[model samples]
Target chain A: MKNKGDIFVISAPSGTGKTTLVRLLLSRFPTLSFSISYTTRLPRPGEVNGQHYFFVSEKEFKKSIAKGEMLEWAKVYGHYYGTPLTFVQEKIAAGKDIVLDIDIQGAQAVKKKMPEAILIFLIPPSWNELQRRIISRSSDSPEEIKKRLEAAKKEILAAREFDYIVINDVLEDALKELVSIIQATKARANKRWPEIKRLLQA
Target chain B: MKNKGDIFVISAPSGTGKTTLVRLLLSRFPTLSFSISYTTRLPRPGEVNGQHYFFVSEKEFKKSIAKGEMLEWAKVYGHYYGTPLTFVQEKIAAGKDIVLDIDIQGAQAVKKKMPEAILIFLIPPSWNELQRRIISRSSDSPEEIKKRLEAAKKEILAAREFDYIVINDVLEDALKELVSIIQATKARANKRWPEIKRLLQA
Candidate 1:
């Protein structure tokens, strides 16, 4: 059998540049497919329907959830969001590496279901830098920023559970580290055993 | 305290060109220190003492082993060879990465003492290629070549116990994979945790 593609679950606090790092990885590794999450929330400006997320009706999202289509789904701010297992399975069967940008809860859920999934945690260089990044976004009020900083603290503490943690000090360095992790994971003994076996027989 | 250097134990069969790959790696990464083994066997012509091996007397080698200085030692063809643990510890304390070229038995011995050591197995692309390479050496008689091939088979079987198996198909590709593995290993959570902790506090 051909080697199965790896499922990479990346998690980070909101201001840690997780999305940017994943985007850079996708650009560099064309074989990787970015998982499109399903969300019940309204689409924001400049967000494409399928590219950003699969914006679904709350009823439809719940229906799919009830049908057990979602690999992992969670509610946030009174809206539901999830990753579709079927899409991920299909991509993996086609030998495409899948990158999932999710929160810690979602990452844990994915891991529970697929023990082979690689969990990566992205974090800001420092708490001060994280605060600076959150403030620079200018999308949140002072109170909201305070709440996010508190959440970031809890998230950073949870990083010990991750397989790899990429510190986003410099964007270039973080990207390189992320890329290396992905490359090395694919070359792991468990994943490449079939090829090794064939070589032995040859 | 500074980050302790990583001990990388690289093992391969007779014909995989593992030495060439390691030489290329050392040239590329100056931070890595090639571990010089202590050998009781007399040095071959052109082999430098301290550079190639310590070239100690059998009595001195036994004394060191009795004193618990050897990290991993083996007797092959009635000649005793070993790695000096004290020298390795000194270099590690000084934060210099050490690369050990050893056999599976030596690797296992080192791992028993230092569980954190990374073991890498380098393999040929195919058995046919391995046979071809071994034959090309032309130093051994036909019967000797047959015995060497038998040993190679056993060594390849032992690769499953290693942390990583690098397939030496193309020289450049294998080098890149080796580099990526080392880079990713240093970025692993356990090794990078202190820096991450400092970053969080900062």
Candidate 2:
């Protein structure tokens, strides 16, 4: 029998460096897997069927949600996005740590279903820095950038509920802290109990 | 204002190599300090005052306990041993991580008073290994060894309440895990909030 690996539910407002941190972490922890989300939106060019996301019809997504197979789902810009419950459960049961990069609302949903999931909120150094990062990316319009900045303010307030709040001030330091948190979780009492017992009895 | 360092409350049954692990950990982390307990028992020859323990009269120990200066105190074999609250508090406030090598009961007491304290329980590789270690010490009487073995069983039950459990299967692996746990605690959200703010604002 395999011990279930812990889940890391990471959330951050746009420009908190969450994407970069996750990418770096994945590279470092080769055993770690990223949760492949399901989306109703049509796949853009170069997006694989099950790599970037699981592209599904709205009807299929709704059917899975009704069957309680979606861990967390949300609607964005008239498109549906959701995390498949089985994907996370299977990976964890097979002893593979999966990182879920979700929003605050999705994070809350995952926490409610799997209270054992480690909730990490990534925060930028300051509001101004976050705003500057968003603007510098040049991916959003003036109005969209303003809306995201406003949303970041509200999201920062919810960081209090997270198990760990990683400050993305310096990329290296934040990444190190993230690594520490993950390593520590793997050594938690519940996860180590079986090994401890076997060690004590051997 | 100084950010308080994290506290580690470590408990292990006799013969689990807790002492050696703590010693190695201290050497690795220069900022970590071991808590010196105030003992009413007579100091053995070669045991230096204040270095091994603060040899104190029973009356002096009781007085300190009454004044709420003792973080956790207990009587073993008709002698009183207590951890001084001020010593630990001062060290932590000075940004020094403090390790409390106490029994399960004392660990519980410390946890109650300092809710943020991280509790770790160390487990031996095997029952035979634990027995071998205790016997190899050649200090305990036959009856004393038997009594200790019984206590170890009870101590293992309390491992459930601890935050992390390090299994001493291989000395190197256990020591590394211990270090990771301490480093992770220092990087906890509450402890790192200040540094994160400074980094972000820099």
Which candidate number would show the highest TM-score if scored against the true structure?
A: 1
RMSD of 1: 1.4
Q: After superposition, how far is residue A16 of candidate 1 from its true place, in Å?
A: 1.2
Q: Which stretches of candidate 2 lie over 4 Å from their true place?
A: A194-202, B1-3, B44-46, B93-96, B139-143, B187-202
Q: What pairs collide in candidate 2?
A: A199-B125
Per-residue lDDT for A33-151 in model 1, tens only? 99999999999999999999999999999999999999999999999999999999998888889999999999989999999898899988888888999999968889988998988
| Candidate 1 interface RMS | 1.3
Which has the greatest DockQ? 1
Fnat of candidate 1: 0.67
Model 2 CA lDDT for position A126 = 77
Q: Give me the candidate number with maximum lDDT.
A: 1
DockQ of each: 0.73, 0.46
lDDT of 2 by residue, B108-157 (tens): 99999999899999888778888898889858799988998887877887
The TM-score measured for candidate 1 stands at 0.97
